[model samples]
Target: MRKVAEGVYRVPARAANTYLVEASKGLVLVDSGLPGSENGILKAIAKLGKEPSDLKLVLLTHRHLDHIGSAAALKKQTGAKLASHPFEKPYAAGTLVISAPRAWSLYGRMVRKLTTLEYWSLKLFRIIKFQTTHVDLAADEESVLDGVGLDGSVVWTPGHTKGSVTLFLNQPSVAIVGDLLRARRGRLVEPLLMESISQTEASVKRVLDLDPEIICPGHGKPLPASKVKIEKRIVKPVVVAKKKEEEEDLEELTSGLF
Candidate 1:
């Protein structure tokens, strides 16, 4: 685990990332990472001199398997309330399975293929199924985090997922964005897989408008907001044909397991 802000710590849980926020009431976890990640997260809490019960809430940014995979285990062990957007509540609770994203470009197509393969692999092998966990708070709009003992708010930022949300801390001027924007090769860029490019663009602008000093993403290292550039054109969908050359160009970006 590494410190991102004064009271915020980032724990790398398998492929995804989980954040631990020291709140007034107790510790609030941002995302639960992948399945079998609860053990690492629990150890992180212990390293902070806190026990499992110190966890007050598990805030899910979206319904993606990597983001909420360990939510059920964490909530059960810590007795913490789980929170997510209303659109994600059912999926998180195991009522509905998440669908594959709309692929607009070569990178997006690669991601879609990988996602489909991963889904089936998990199901066929019964390796790690997404365990359902009830969502206590259905955050649809700007929700004050004080209710969960944090001096921040969760802003609905859809695109990457219909229910994706970004948590902003007022005092530290930080935004914990889950797959809303990824830090890749020292720059912040839109995620490869998204439901709608238009919605993703709009959400990116919303987060930039917040003017966070530090932006912490779900996949990579935190970056200073000033160093981040807003390339409006990049968010627009590119009409890339499924050609051999185009696929090779996106090799680096599509290398991750995301």
Candidate 2:
């Protein structure tokens, strides 16, 4: 884990990233990495001169496997409260089935094709699934995390998922974005695994509105917010009504247990 700001540390856990926020009372972890990632988190915390029990809260940006997998274990180990948007609470509780939105672009299609194989294998063999845990619900608004020892708030930035959110730190003007965007070839790229392109665009605009100086994505290196130019390269939503044939083809191609 490396400190990106005064009190924020970023740790890469496998393909995902986890962040630690040193607050007045204790540490607040953002996105508990993958399952079996507690060891790494502990090591990272140790580097900060802290321990697992120092974690007072684990805030999830969304309820994807890679984000929420280690949540249960972390909570159990640290006795920290778990918080997330109400829409994502069910997913974290293991009460809702997890599925990705269908891809429409060639790049999206190809990436999905490669990722779905791993997803299918995990599902088919029941290799890994998030453990059921109690979660406290937080509103999709700013200042939600104020009294929780962190110097930031969680903003609703839905796009990658309905309950996706971004953590905005006041002092450093940094945003801990959990897959709402990513770094592609050193440039900021909005996530392709999206439920709605329009909503994703809106969320990106919301993040931009904060004028964050540093962006810590869930799956890639931290990017300077200035490098994330969304206006010129925005991806327009596909007009489904005008592409019935293409829709049919996509459905046929992705109909299986993807």
Best by TM-score: 2
lDDT by residue for model 2 over 1-258, one digit each (tens)? 787888888988755999988888899888987677888998898888897888888889897878887888889988888889888988778777677655546567667667853473357327655476778657454444665656667888888889988888888889998988888889888676677677888988899898899999998889899777553333444445227536776999899958
Top model number, lDDT? 1
Clashes of each: 0, 0
Question: TM-scores across all candidates?
Answer: 0.87, 0.88
Evaluated at residue 53, the lDDT of candidate 1 is: 99
Reference-based lDDT, each prediction: 0.82, 0.78
What overall lDDT, based on C-alpha atoms, would model 1 receive against the true structure? 0.82
Q: Which ten residues in a row have the lowest lDDT in candidate 1?
A: 236-245
Residue-pair clashes, model 1: 0
Candidate 2, backbone clash total: 0
lDDT of 2: 0.78
Model 1: CA > 4 A from native: 117-125, 141-144, 234-258
